[model samples]
Target: MADDRRKNRIFRGSLGLLLLSLVLSGGCWDRRELETLAVVTGMGLNYAAQGDGYEVAFQIVRAAQLQSASGGAGGGGELKPVWILRSTGPTVFEAVRNATFQSSRRLFLSHNQVLIISEAVAKGGLLPALEFFVRDHEPRNTQWLLLTPDEPVEILDAAAGLERVSALAIVDLMKQYQLTSKIKPVYLADYIKTRIEKTTANTLPIIRIYETAGKKELLLDGTAILKEDRLVGFLDHKETRGLLWVLGEVRGGVITVDLPGGGKATFEIFDAIPKVKVEFKEGRVQVKIEIKERAGLGAQTTYADLSTPEQFKKLENLQTKAIEDEIRAALAKAKAYKADIFGFGEYLYKHDHRTWQRLQKEWERYFVDAQVEIKIEAMVEELGLVTRPATYRELRK
Candidate 1:
């Protein structure tokens, strides 16, 4: 037994040594030089008006220009952010191959951060248009998906930032703003799943790039509402926040409430908890949304005293009312657009498939008319600094 064990150990050690030797001698597989690889930071899909098929645009990052572009250089010396390459074909794969007409090395998309779909291409049905992305093995699944009113190719070219181009800026925005803003970061996988599981309802963050207001910036505001993978309408910034509140994704944002007279006191929502309850009566379904929140004093333009517990309670009530107002407004707009971005339809489908089938055909209709009761309950913990005697110094006196 001892002899056999020694032999087995020797064989294992020898095999490990051989593998290490092979790895050390081997070279990188499918390795390409940085200059050879055209870094694809963003992809745009648009409709070819000529009826040729789909229009695909690649945002090729220019490293040479970007390297020394930020050294207090004027616009002339600044780097060209993206070299636009266009192709049209029956499918994304074919279009990608066609893009080689203007390139050399294989176009790499794994590092891509955003995918923009034009209104025309998305209206045709985003699922089929994006099937290539979902089914193909190129694009990252976590890529941020966006919808633009103009051709997506425009956004890819509208690189405007001191540090990085639009694509890199977008990648940073998604990472940072999520912690402090209620904008739901739209990912490619989430959007596709949202369409498949529910009544074809989802939202994509909207981005627009234009040399307007004396500045060129890639602005992402509100959300593009989609019903069955088609553009129906859009939500304003506040409406987007409300949608996030419904989705239980509210983290931190400022909520301003009007006081009794004319002053407006704003509170920063430091924490938020959304409670949604679904009930079924006979064959009908009802939803109750309870948005509970805790906030701190962000602004106090009102002369109202917030030192007392009663004063804090009043402020909490005021904030709650403001939150409810925004929620109602967002819900009304969503219903009018016939877009179920709140995923209420999805919840119904998951819990009760039978009722969902009955409601699927007219889910939008029911959603528009369905009685959704909303209740907001908020509390104020701290008023920034002094909450004991600042409001009424006379009490201390």
Candidate 2:
């Protein structure tokens, strides 16, 4: 009888321990349901016109509406897939927290893909506005950082073309920058990295809203040049590509040059490799950029047979001149602004530390007066499917 009582006690103890284990092993004690959170895909910062605070805009996805749209629900009463909310505070952190007062659910930012800053905020300085994002644990560093002249909220609210959300559309645009190589896409991390450098400046693609056919459209225009943390000037598309060439970021794009025979030919870039050398000579900084590029004949406006050896050589010369001109233009702009966007100062610092140290304090003066030489070797490898223009045979006939 005593043995049976001991067995019963042991069984009760085991059962209690099992129940406790079950309770403790259940995870997600503080997990919030998806319906209780607002998913923010894009965040924009701008200076408040009425006050000395920041105006923060968020592009929140309407989960249910997006689902219904993807599910092929055809109803005229369907709602939009995103909502743009604006909030204001004395600082970015406070502005973010202030959003909770307007939003019923917490604003979630882990899914954010783009961060747009207005020209006003960017011109004032990015460190003050970007501190919150850099210090926060939730915002990712991979998000594309863009500058805009228009209202940040307006850009966020612009139509997204095929995309349901404008922010995602902006992300797609950034990914396809290699197609034109005219805009340099800068991420939050990239900006931060350049900012940490003492002499290297930074660049960010410019995003703007334009009206086309009575519809608002988003466009990635030129580029914003920032010296240190403040916006200094801008670069046009051609100038931006020139900057890309020096940075060895040109992958795929088209270069059109006028032929000596009074027609134009467009060459699609297959490969381009830039070799840059920064030297201190004659008590001045000299930068030499040699770009070796290979391209194929994409299209021609003339009926001349460009496939011939003589004509191909001429095309290559023209292509080389075109590239050199672009680089020179970009260099001129950079020197005018006294901005070392090409990181020549950093190059000197790494290769010749003593020279960099002596000039680091007055690097801007050295950079403005720096002598730059550009050399381009362009090759026309392919002539596409047809040797001559399609109308060449007809013209010969």
Candidate 3:
């Protein structure tokens, strides 16, 4: 027993010594000072004009700009919010290392909030360069991912007024869009998972940058369709809502219902809860989607009061039609793209694996011709007891 205890003590002593020696010898082998790095706020990747090459562009914020005293990504005091660094490499990681040639500090990615890629690169295939992203612990999975119609550099360079720098502005812009719009937020982790599942597909938010009067601005183009890992097509604002509806991701979007009179009434959705169901019957798949929502009347064109059940029913029917129309629009787009990004196939896989495997073989062909029926029913419970529908309602010429 004594000898056994002695052996245990020896093992502990040896481990401690080994750890101590290693810790003392390592000496910050990977250490790089903050000043040594450009501190990347965003990154953009494109195809280089060579064989198996890529152009990786970095959006870096001067660390001093991020410090409150130096006017970080939020202030305006003669400090640039972002700077650009570009390099060529065979892969994304190689491009990242090459960016260091122009900077004194190692690139910082922790604050990176948005990643924009060119449409060509995205259509070519994103899964290849994306592998390293997941393996590396530095880049976050929650960061917003956007694809640009133009070269990613141009979009990355667009100056936004909200954030001190363009990179931060894009991030802030995305947050605002999500908060006020019905657009679905696509993240790296979710995107990759959808691509890997085979039963599901993925989408990315698209951004377009334009310049006027020496200042850059951005626009949310909509959603890009992905098949396997390649972008097949894009969805417009209405189509995006359709996609969001299918995925049950609708949060808030203004819905305009053509009223019985001239002009239109705008209803802003406050809450949306959508449910999807998939079932097989008689050798066919049926997908049923249900969306329940509450909305505020943002505008009214005619004299109408919401205090009556008749008005509620009228608005409910109109909303249902409007939502269903959007859903149909989205369905038409997905069918055209022949990709089941809404994961209707995923629902099938969950319910019945045996059929899903068979369906997986010819999923594209089936999706192209498959019948996806969308049913939307919305109810207008209250108008918040409005004294008047709109200023125009009480006005007389």
Q: Which candidate has the top score in TM-score?
A: 2
* Residue-level lDDT tens digits of model 2 in 101-149: 9999999888889999999999999989988888988899999999999
Find the 10 residues in a row with the least total lDDT in model 3. 69-78
Candidate achieving higher TM-score, 2 or 3: 2
Q: Please report, in order, the local distance difference test score of every candidate based on alpha carbons.
A: 0.80, 0.91, 0.78
**Which stretches of candidate 3 lie above 4 Å from their native place?**
1-29, 66-79, 390-397
Against the correct fold, how does model 2 do in TM-score?
Answer: 0.93
State how far residue 181 of model 3 sits from its true place (Å).
3.3
- Number of the top-ranking candidate, with lDDT as the measure: 2
Which of 2 and 3 is ahead in lDDT? 2
- Could you tell me the lDDT of residue 385 within candidate 2? 91
Which runs of model 2 end up more than 4 angstroms from their true locations?
Answer: 1-30, 392-397
Q: Tell me how far the alpha carbon of residue 40 in candidate 1 is from the true structure, in angstroms, after superposition.
A: 0.3
Could you tell me how far off, in angstroms, the CA of residue 121 lies in candidate 2 after the best superposition?
A: 0.2
Q: Please list the residue runs of candidate 1 whose C-alpha ends up more than 4 Å from where it truly belongs after superposition.
A: 1-31, 70-79, 179-182, 212-215, 386-397
Clashing pairs in 1: none
Candidate 1 global Cα RMSD: 5.5
